[model samples]
Target: MTTVTTPDAIVTAARGWIGTPYLHQASHRGIGADCLGLLRGIWRELYGAEPEPVPPYSRDWSEPSGDERLWAAAARHLLPGGAEAPGQVLLFRMRSGGVAKHLGVQGAVGRKPTFIHAYSGHGVVESPLSAPWRRRIVARFTFPEV
Candidate 1:
């Protein structure tokens, strides 16, 4: 894999995808991408290709599958970033009894933290990291070796 020489470069690359729509399984810029696709796009821009080809997945991919597969995969590739940090990847469990599936990028942290994510109808949005959203986070990741 190609190396990402700088952290700002990662942020810049992720920011470039701000307006893309949330189309499941796509990883193209200006066209469409879901939350994971946004990260896939960033990985491609930073490293020239995805570390591993993603398998076909459903919207409820891990929610009912009863496995923390996404979190596990992230653990293998991304450095753990503690609880709060700008530009960190945040994983969310959409329900109380479901597996962690949803993912987002923390854009700000402190009194008024915010995260960027692609919601089904909202597309890509930087949302306030409110208590409710905070409660669902299962893992946090920084780019590897950063």
Candidate 2:
């Protein structure tokens, strides 16, 4: 049976990964996971197997080539252009004129919004969606219906 993916469920699943170590291209819950890996783990919990295989990626994430590879992958797998809400996937551009690479799952909305992500040094954490972070958001998306 296919599970109905809900915002609350997504948030809960992401929250479960809190404190997981940040490992490049790894997706094992509580052990290691990158930002994309966090989303992949949540996708597995909500839907089953991943829709596609993820090739090895570098820390730059195709930035040197000026390609939005991560954004393109997200567009392929997720429903784009969703209203800001808990559980939405947030794509961020870490700097001006750079490829959007960082990702986070929206945790709390409205006043004092937060997002859960696996940062380089901090591991998995739910941080306030402060203005600096908000300014870097390049796109928002929701998981596809199962």
Candidate 3:
């Protein structure tokens, strides 16, 4: 038996992982996860298997390679959408001209906007979508409904 996954379900599953310790290249619910790990964990909960095998990556996962690896992978797997919906995946560039490496799942939208991410030193936490964060958004995507 498999669970029916919806946008709301994705948000709920991601929220359930709040407080997990941030760990590079790891993804286990309530254990450890990075920004990408958090998303991968939610994906596992929504679907029985990972869409593709993730290669072991360094803390700087392809930034030196000058490729938008995270953004590319999101485009390949998730549905493209505007960043105005709960459960949408958000890709961010840490700095101008940098690769879009950070990721988060949108939480509350419109009023009291927030997003869930496993930030370094912060672990998994839902952060307010402040103007600074909003400005860094490079791409948005939603999990494909099952």
Task: Name the candidate that leads on TM-score.
Answer: 2
- Which lDDT tens digits does candidate 1 get at residues 1-146? 33663545666677777888889988787888898898888877766767887899888886665878888888887888875777788999888888888888887778998888877887777789999999999888988752
29-137: candidate 2 lDDT, tens digit per residue: 9999999999999999988999899999999999999989999999999998567899899999999999999999999999989999999999999999999999999
Model 3 spans > 4 angstroms off: none
> Quick one: ranking by TM-score, best first?
2, 3, 1
- Report lDDT (CA) for all predictions: 0.80, 0.94, 0.89
Question: Which TM-score value belongs to model 3?
Answer: 0.95
Error of 2 at 31 (Å): 0.5
Looking at candidate 1, what is the lDDT of residue 132?
96
C-alpha RMSD by candidate, in order: 2.1, 1.3, 1.3
By lDDT rank, best first, the candidates go: 2, 3, 1
What's the true lDDT of residue 10 in model 1?
65
Cα displacement (angstroms), candidate 2, residue 42, comes to 0.7
lDDT tens readout by residue for model 3, 1-146? 12766668888998999999998888997789999999888888888799999999888878888987888899999999863888899999989988888999999988689999999998999999999999999988988878
Error of 2 at 13 (Å): 0.5
